[model samples]
Target: MCDFTVAVFRPDDDRLEDAVELLESLGATPVPDPMLAVEPTGASPRDDADYTILTSKTGAELVAGAYPGTDSDGVADGGARTDRWNPGEATLCAVGPKTADALRERGYDPEIVPQEYTSSGLVAALEDRVDGARVEVARSDHGSPVLLEGLEAAGAYVHETVLYRLVRPEGSGDSTELAAAGGLDVACFTSSLTVTNWLEAADERGVRDAALEGLSNATVGVIGEPTGETAVAAGIDVDLVASEATFETLATETVELAAPTYYE
Candidate 1:
């Protein structure tokens, strides 16, 4: 019955809301809130592209703007002329189930979901098979170019779309203030951007030290090795790295790290 306090820095999202619901179900109280929002940087998919590579659900959702049913979930308008978009014969590569679910919701049947669930994993899964193919990669505005470079090195022409950008809402960096109030037990990071955004917010709010001190004492859980690196770069102490790079896994690891009583 020891409900631990936690923090999440992803864009406000239904899937994230679902993950938080799962965490709450595990007896955690998320702090500074998980309602952080990521804004799309006006990138659109090409209907004529030979292949579509979705690294995250965010990429899938951004690409969905071209589809009929999922237009509302797509990146905002004026960014791309997706009206006549048709994904004819284009192969879809989803990084994981979450991305696949988003693709499916938008009437796409993902042809690839890398077993490893990471950028390197995706490349390993498709590189050998996509020789001479033109692949479009959709991801966050600040997504690493390793996937692009890797695909190109493997002889696949890669196109990248900036699906979204993480930005703090006006006056949003009260994380340190929240943690200083005490009771926050877990600090959760879902992506490199989350780590960057949290640190930026903390610094902007002039409470970087307090936030760092507070989080240093908390069980810090990151979604993957990259996220762990980002957290460390942001001066966050990492105590847990999810075996898999997924929010679901992050939540599970969080439970084991911050509230083992309910982990099972």
Candidate 2:
């Protein structure tokens, strides 16, 4: 078994568990240290139309709760008209399978999803169809600009709806976590905010060197290229990137890349 322990900074417990499972299956130990907390956006829902794009699962869940009882699937409640989402007829683009599955479970079938599962990939996939189309993006308040910008540049009338927000976890001592991270081998960053929060936490904990050294020594795995870029900018050497920008793919690649230090 590999002696190295992989550190994960995902906020969700279920996602953390999934990553841990993948690492353990490959004999690599996992240490979860979530830096950011996700919360629902207080924004009210707007009228729906032909195309609705779900960018993240959290956003989907928020919309589902806001629009309760509208769909039989119980995913979306009642904000927008359900009849507008004609499944195979209307086009719905999702950033990842999780978001796509969320839509599916809610009674809306997505027609377009990127193979790479990143904002850029999703934008690229929808560029052709988005031209001159009316598109609504359901996403977090802190979502990336790539999707919205790309769609607008492609002549699509894009309306972005905030569904959630990411903030620093309350009562979590950033400095303490960073100080403790010195013993960790790998630091996994899933989002840009995670990178920012982790740096702040490390600085607060007075373990910047430990965090930096750990990141430099061990592989820094990221879910997408944007996140990888953030790590590189923070002086963390990235070793592996998920082929598809999903937690499952991230875990899979993380285990495979760290397999040299792990046992089956």
Point out the worst 10-residue segment of candidate 2 by lDDT.
78-87
Using TM-score as the measure, the top candidate is 1
Q: Which residue pairs show backbone clashes in model 1?
A: none
> How much does candidate 1 score in TM-score?
0.87
Stretches of candidate 1 off by over 4 Å are 66-84, 260-264
Model 2, stretches more than 4 Å misplaced? 66-90, 171-182, 261-264
lDDT of 1 at 30: 62
lDDT of each: 0.73, 0.69
Candidate 1 has an lDDT of 0.73
Q: What is model 1's C-alpha RMSD?
A: 3.2
Q: What is the lDDT of residue 158 in candidate 2?
A: 86
